[model samples]
Target: MKRRTFLGSVAAAGVGAAVAPGLLAPAVAQAATYKKRVTGADLDTNSRWQVAGTDLGIPYVLENGSIGYLFGDTFNSPWPEQQNNDWRSPVMLRSAVHPGEAGGIVFDSAAKVAGNGRAPEIMHNGHNGIGIDNLWEVTVIPNDGISFPETGRQLVSYMSIEHWNPGPRYSLWKSRYAGLAYTDNGNDFVRTNLKWFNDADNADPFQMWTMQRDGDWVYVFSVRSGRQDGPMMLRRVPWEQLFDPAAYQGWGWNGSNWGWGRPCSPILNGRFGEPSVRRLGDGTWVMAYLNCATGNIVTRRANTPDSAWNNEKIQVTFAQEPSLYGGFIHPWSGAGANELHLMVSKWTHGPAGNSTAYHVSQYVGSV
Candidate 1:
């Protein structure tokens, strides 16, 4: 099992013991009301046409009103194997099922992969396998992606990893830098020239990102790669200047007042992994992620993206599911309803590869 998974099992013994004393106050109420598996082996979504098993089910609304899920490290093989896993680091899956509908979110097919498709990767990651160099990038993993409102242009943020080292948690992957890629037709993506952040700065907070749109501005939440012992940062840019790297301004405090500017500061301090932030219909902002300290998936709400995240931290998943991560909020959730559905990924590491439980799951929470 992975280090995080092992910690999760240990945390399951007692959530209170896993978490630091006084790190968080008691939750006012439980956020997770219902839970079920959405996609994986033996589920309805597993097949040759779409995802059999994958991770990072990051969701965003498309221009056509359908929901698009950005997945990482997908496999066409129904059962986990060491080789010939039909590997695709990044792939796109589309679904028309509404969150409020009776059945859970069901993926229809791949975005670009055609008939009898095997869920082909939408983006390029240079060459496959380890010890191979195809210029500066060896393997690029998609973190989070979103579609523009009017233009419908797709933008995804990714990390360029130099290599993956075996044994240990923090040293698992050595990332060179993080950058952005855009696609107008949804099939071909062009990597931008600007580097969002590099690994040279040990404390850079933009290594992982999750983006959401609010009116004329788009809000981005970021954390480090290891997803532990780091602070979450906030940034926003105008919709018109979406592709302009310099247009983004970070939220920071100077021991006096909080404002938006360069060199963003931490909005919340904790162990975070794969954060998901979305604006509710009533303008309330909800953020969800795997809290490594407590070994539980949690959600916190704030009035604004730059506001203090002092609200009650609601636990969305039980302490037992330690291998779970990637809490991507459904776009259509909480628009005019009281329930919010989140797409969460769960996987157990195996010597052959990933176990059959490796797939995306759903958790319904009260808004």
Candidate 2:
């Protein structure tokens, strides 16, 4: 999730090491903005993540009206005081819950939901076999798209193994190959069908950030450049072809038309976090992401998924919380001044002092 990893020249097939940056026009003042509303909502559970653990940030409220919360390595508290939020379990966690009508959430402490177990295997070196293979995020697309089943499925993004060493020459641990893990009923995923498109030479070798339906096509928000601390790129494919690489189209600012199978262009500059996008009530698309440098969750609005966006507002900051990111907006948040709910994961100051916590916490209210 750091920015410096995208340094070396890519060896992709014909895409070249240098992709021309799309120049942005002079800015205009924006009207739609954000204001801090909800801080956080904590959960009560034990060490096994039967109820508690960190790394529970990326979430998808299922079409069947349940919440599917995806998490990375979970922290297993060693002490009886569940608040002792220290120590981590090497495996991933997928916790689910039924949203209550009263605005509170309750997850079953007994439900057998074991997230992606162990590391990734498809063409991954994992820092020469030492990095952790993790699935960074998950997306749930309705089955209405073409060639898809009548029932919706989840598209989980995979992050190959990598070592974490933050500093100059941070390209030591690079994410080479990432792809999607398909799921039918939201919880159970088909492990054998894992498909990956290598990002070694291309711009976006990771999961296409957050994807949303923009009219007839599903717009994919992806990160490349510095991987995390990089511009947000745009890609689109018809609803029925969301998983078809050949059907994908990249935004061509100069041509003003989508160039099918062409290279992607930077749509948003600066270090934007993993973006969570949704179509607003007025038809404009709004994306919520952490401004990594500032440690604040910001929102941006655009007329179309692939258009220039106006910086809306900074909603929440990590003044006390520290590494709080993964601002995932709830699908039920329907436009206008209605309340916006974010499923955010923050790195708490651990028991051993400053170690980053990987717990997924929830925040309610609006922007």
Candidate 2, 1-367: lDDT as tens digits:
2212211222211111213343333223322222322112233344224333444345454445444444443334422124544323222222343221344444442213443222221122232334333543221211111112345765555544333333222222334444455556544444333445435433453443577765578777766422244456777888776567778787754565545456776666654456688775567676786555555666766787755676446566565345666677755555555356566666554566444344554555443
Question: lDDT scores for all predictions?
Answer: 0.68, 0.46
Question: Per-candidate TM vs. native?
Answer: 0.85, 0.67
Q: Which stretches of candidate 2 lie over 4 Å from their true place?
A: 1-42, 45-51, 78-103, 108-149, 167-173, 192-208, 214-216, 225-228, 255-261, 280-282, 350-358, 365-367
**How many clashes in candidate 1?**
0
What's the distance in Å from true for residue 259, model 1?
1.1
lDDT of 1 by residue, 242-265 (tens): 778889998877767778875776
Which candidate number would show the highest TM-score if scored against the true structure?
1
Candidate 2 Cα lDDT to native:
0.46
- Report the alpha-carbon TM-score of model 2 versus the true structure: 0.67
